[model samples]
Target chain A: MTLCRYWRLDRHPEGNTRFERFLSLHEEACAPLAPGEVRIAVEWLSMDAGTRMWMSPRTDGYQPPLPLGSRMVGLVLGRVIESLDPAYPPGVRVRGFGQWADVATVVPALAGLEVVDETVADPRQHFGALGMNAWTALVGVREVAAVRPGEWLAVSAAAGATGSLACQIGRNLGARVVGIAGGAEKCRFLLDELGVDMAIDYRAEDVSARLSQVPGGVHAFFDNVGGPILDAVLGNMAHYGRVAICGMIAGYDSDVAMPGPAKFDQVLMRRLRIEGFFIPDFLERGAEFLPQLRTWLDEGRLAVRFDETQGLENVPAAYERMLTGRNIGKVIVRL
Target chain B: MTLCRYWRLDRHPEGNTRFERFLSLHEEACAPLAPGEVRIAVEWLSMDAGTRMWMSPRTDGYQPPLPLGSRMVGLVLGRVIESLDPAYPPGVRVRGFGQWADVATVVPALAGLEVVDETVADPRQHFGALGMNAWTALVGVREVAAVRPGEWLAVSAAAGATGSLACQIGRNLGARVVGIAGGAEKCRFLLDELGVDMAIDYRAEDVSARLSQVPGGVHAFFDNVGGPILDAVLGNMAHYGRVAICGMIAGYDSDVAMPGPAKFDQVLMRRLRIEGFFIPDFLERGAEFLPQLRTWLDEGRLAVRFDETQGLENVPAAYERMLTGRNIGKVIVRL
Candidate 1:
């Protein structure tokens, strides 16, 4: 029997600072695949902000809380090692919601497993340019926020996975992009790497003041961090502006509900719109989204900077880095 | 010269309770109509929650705040007494943004002036079933909130002008309507008069608790009173629910920005949509909407309960009565 080592939830975390105390690295024998089950040798684990909500004890989150002593679940980019499902046969490069384990087993249907294109030069593009983040960024910038050509699009948490992709997508669509991220380094990453029109260092600069300089105010906002950053964007939004909420990483650590934006009155005052969207809801439309994502990737337009942490044991550290915004791009654990 | 008696805004109001401290009644000779201007012998004044925001010194409101010492502006239904613009010929029953006066003058185009239909059985329907309130309700419920048939629709300030109309509109579309008002009398009015499926006395009963009784949670929320009531609704909203903000009378009295809803995170957690809309933005489409509104009115499906207060001298009292929720249905000053 193969040994499957994974991180397990010991308890619900209190905050971002002390994730180690609430999770422990554990090991188990890999069981034989059940009917319609697929086994994966998890090559890399994608650290996402939304799943952080599921780790909390809150029952009202997007999904149920992860039970104590359960294998920590996350998106894994890997090759199928063994499978009972004929549709997902052995040796196919796949991506889905899997455990933080070197060896992970999942029911293909429930885990949103999909066979990725193997002909791509870089297989990591499954977790990068052509992944869920790219899909989310496309849908958010193009459809939800409806960023039109020559419109000003503001993206919060702009140096991170989805936000960075969104910044590039906005620029690609001929919209002027303003990327809001913490620290001078992330701001530089947004400006130089993502080629955003404006980069606001949310930590050092006055975000609202910086945004106020944009003529006619921000027309479309793709938001990831949703606490004070959301309020900052709201107050500076143009009349009839659209806000697409992708993540609320600011309140991901806590079980308690996050307070809504302090400038919520702007919704009425400015005729603004705020819509919340999840990418998983659009999984069935992946084929439709993938071509555009691949075209951008092939043209070297969609650049993704991965902040990788080596080893399965480092998933918790990587997760903390992602949640705390210390990582400059997509935070991932290479198992 | 026609001596026009009107109310003047001397200073911004600190709160709703004491409008007398800020505004005072005054009389001036009605000025001759300028090029493109028209004068009205005001017969009635419509008190709306939105204009209350205009009474403050908020520079960033839906429009520039009414200048201090200027005439208090509101919707007026009357016969054109004089005109320089042929579009508003004398003796035509017209409706537009006119002053709170016995005689008022306006630049027809800027005032949203339109020669109203005189064939209706009750001319009050110009400020009632075929009025801005009806248009607001139709657009808000049908387009903004996008309430589908057989869905549950919750309306705040349900006994008031726009809210009462919205409740009936939702029911007319075959959606279940829950009316939330301040007291038992308003609750009874909502249930007995408006025929809402449920009526919650917001001052007595728990707004969120009453909303929780909805089977799949509130699918569409037409909110006028923002603040705790908005927060309550936000928390109990169904996944993919729509919130159409028509008014925020809760914060109308103060110039200070009102706090955003505390339960705002639900916007992300519930995948909900929140939109703010103004009726003036839709005035150009009034003719397109008049047919359905007229049909509903003729069928007795769209009933407007007028809480009428007579005389322009009592405009301050009537404004107070409307703002304080002391009146059920549309509040109007019949001159």
Candidate 2:
């Protein structure tokens, strides 16, 4: 019998609380799967700021909160240890929405797990730019907000996984890309590593002042942080601008209502548009994106950065670093 | 020379200044025009809440405040008394962006004034239902928000000119029309007169509670009054709802910054779309709305209402009544 551990939140806090009593890992013995089910031995787990949101009840139509004594729901790379389903046999690698635990039993359709294709150049690319992260960025840009090429695109949380991909994709489409991040290092990485045209360290520079550097104001804004940064983008948006609101990372961990100076007058006055999206929705359109993504990767047109953490025990620490903006690219825990 | 009287605001007020003190009407000789110009004897002037917006600095992209003592900029209907241009011969009636004066001069292109067409019905229809106000409503519904038939369509200031027309047009398109107003009288007008599905008197019942009675959340919202009412709409907006913001007459007169209760979270969570629009941009599509409007009017499918205030001297008092929501339908000052 193999011991599988699951991480669950004990209490929702007002701020980041990784080392605190909130997160606890409980161990259990692996059990046999039901008919037509498969047990995956988790290999890599994707850590995003959205993981913090599962701590509280979903404010809107999003999925319900993670139960107190249950494992956290997240994306993971894994191998099928045992399968009652013929399609996914033992030793086959796959990607799916799974728990932070080492082993999970799920039906093939519900898990959204796809058998890894060997023809793909880099299988790890499934967890990074050519995978879920890239799909999300593209969905936010194309489907949610419907951003057109040659427009000015501004993304908040610029150096992180989703933001980094959004910046590069905006550049690839001939758009002027501007990024906003917390620290100078992330901002520098956004400009130097990700090829973002302008990077604003919200901790250092005034967002509204540097907005003038864009000249025509932002035509499209990809927002990850949803407090003062969202408010600031509303002010600088051009007439008929579209804002792709991917996540409210800044407000996720907070137990209280996030407050910031706001001006909705600009929303009506400038005739702006804002929308939110999740990556899973892209699955319906996955066949369309996967081919283009593979081509972009093969042609060296796509670039991705990863801040990989080794071992399942270090997943908690990686979550902390990602929340604090310490990681440069996609934060992944390798088991 | 014909004497032309013009009303001007001598000084900008920091707060609500009584009309008796701030406004002054002075008479001057009707100046003759140069080539390609026509002299129009003003017949009626529109004195809606939009006039109050002209008192401040040009923040909303309208022209600068009327030069200290010059006439106000607004829509007025007039008859061509003298013509320096062949296009506008004497006795032809026209509409132009002229003002409080008895007579004004304009270039041929600016003289929107044409002989009132006698082909169909009531001449007053041209200024209210079959004119710019109706055209604006159609544009707000079809173009900006893109309201589909059988959708829930709600409008604020429902008995007013724009709102009243909006309800009829939305209903004509098979929408379930709901309206919000300040009193029972206007509420009655919305249902019995304008043919809306339901009407909510904000002074009587809870707006939020009444919205629950709506089968599903509204699909298209036509907002003229922006304040707490806008907040109420934001809370109950359907998934992927479209909010067409036409005017903020509710907050236009306030001197202090009236930022409607912060609800950016709703815009993101609900994937709601909010857009502001002007009729000028839709003029190209204006003619397209007229034939349909005329059909609705001729077939007795449309209702037209006006709050007519006679004489130029009553413009200030008439404006005061409009600001107070005393007028139901277009507030017109007849000469």
Candidate 3:
């Protein structure tokens, strides 16, 4: 019998909860794979702010309840242990929406399993810049907002995995990228390290005042950290602006009385369009997206970075760090 | 000098004001036409709920304030008495944005104005069925929502001009139309007279409870009375539903404290889209919309009705009556 470790919620903290190890997983934990299913030995797990929102009672259109004593829902890169489906075979590498655990058995119908190229530089890269966060960033901003080149693209939580990819995507698409992050370090990293045009340290600056510095109003806003930051961006949006509601990281940790209280007069005044998306909805387009994305990555037009924690033992810490903004770029727990 | 009585704001109301009338000149009051301008002899004036929103403080993007002692901005159907532009000639009947006065002058730039077809049924039909409100209903529900034929289309303020037109548009597009109006009388008018598929008297039925009675959740919502009615619609929107923010007639004349408090959580939860539109923005497409709309009107597939108040002197009283929901369709003042 194989042993698999997991971080399960012992009790939800009234304020915030830290991931703690509880009971270990045994082979019996997973029901036998029926036809069209595969057993996977998870190699890497991804952590994101979006997962935090799911940890609590979700007011948003998310999935079924996140169980109290279960591995967190996130992306995982793994090797197939056994297979009942023709699409995914034994020893093949695949990545998809999976539990943050050492081993996960999934149905091929629900899995985004694909044969990983043996020629790829690193396996970890699939869980980082080239994975779920990157895909979400590109699709959310491009498909949802339809942002054009030379237009202003503003992103919040700019140092996070999705935000970094969004900044680069905005730049590559010819948009003037502006990032908003919580601290000076993240702000500097966004501007200097990531090569973003401008960075607003939201903790240090009044977002509204900093927004006024942008001469032409923002054409599209990539909102990763919703709240007052979103309100500020709304005020400076140009007419016919689009707001891509990617995630609401800022208010995810805290049980805020309400989300943002800013009046939506700007929506009418600017004639803005707002849309929210969850990545799984675009899986069908991944075949179309991945090829173009791979070309960009190979040609140096796109970049992906990560803050990785080694071992499944550190998965809890990595998740905590992701929520606290202690990590820049993608947060992954490596096996 | 001919006497042309018109309603002027005697004093800006502190809260909600009653419209008061005064006598005015038919010709002397009009500013002389500059080059490429035309003067019109007013025949009929269109009244709408938006006028009250316009008269309020410019808190949001409702409308520009009406000049303290100027003629109220309205759409008037009149014959061109004089023309300084070649595009327009004397004796040509046209409809354009003009004052409530019996006589007015317009710039030639405003020529090529909406003209009433002498060959068509009624002159007032141009202002109601084919005018701003109808156009707003069309663009707001169709273009903004991108509504599908088999979807459920729910409209608030069902008896209003825009609301009724939206119901017909929904029917024309092959959707199941459900209307929410204040009273049984209006509901009957919607179901019996307008032939709307479903009509709900919001005052009699529990809106949220009743909305659930519709098979699937609402696909598109046309919100005219923005308040608890909107709250009910938002609560039940299906995933990716669209809300057309046509008018907030219920709260336009409200005191600051009485303003409608919207529950925006529903927006995020359902991944819904809400869009607001003004008629002028869609003017270029009028060439496409008008011909089709005219055909619909002529074929009896569409109906245009009005609450006509005789005499320009009664405009103020008409305005008060219009806001109070005593009038139906387009409220017009006959000269």
Off by over 4 Å in 1: none
- The candidate 1 chain A region of ten consecutive residues with least summed lDDT is A253-262
lDDT of 3 by residue, B9-81 (tens): 4444443335553323233455567887777888888877766655655655554666566766677889988
Residue A91, candidate 1: alpha-carbon lDDT: 95
In model 1, the clashing pairs are none
Per-residue lDDT value at A251 in model 1: 86
DockQ of candidate 3, scored on C-alphas against the true complex (2 decimals): 0.36
Candidate 2: stretches off by over 4 Å: A58-61, A84-87, A143-145, A256-261, B13-17, B58-67, B84-86, B107-116, B255-257
lDDT of 3 by residue, A1-335 (tens): 54555555544434434556432332336566787877789888888666665666544435654767666667778898878987788888988777777887676557666666655687776765567777888897788777898898998888888888888888888899999988888988887777888899888999988887887788888887767888889878877888888776656665432443364655554577777677777777777777767777887866767788898777767777888888778888888
TM-scores of the models, in the order given: 0.99, 0.93, 0.92
Displacement of residue A4 (Cα, Å) in model 3 is: 2.1
Clash number by candidate, in order: 0, 3, 0
B145-223: candidate 1 lDDT, tens digit per residue: 9999999999999999999999999999999999999999999999999999999998999988988998999999999
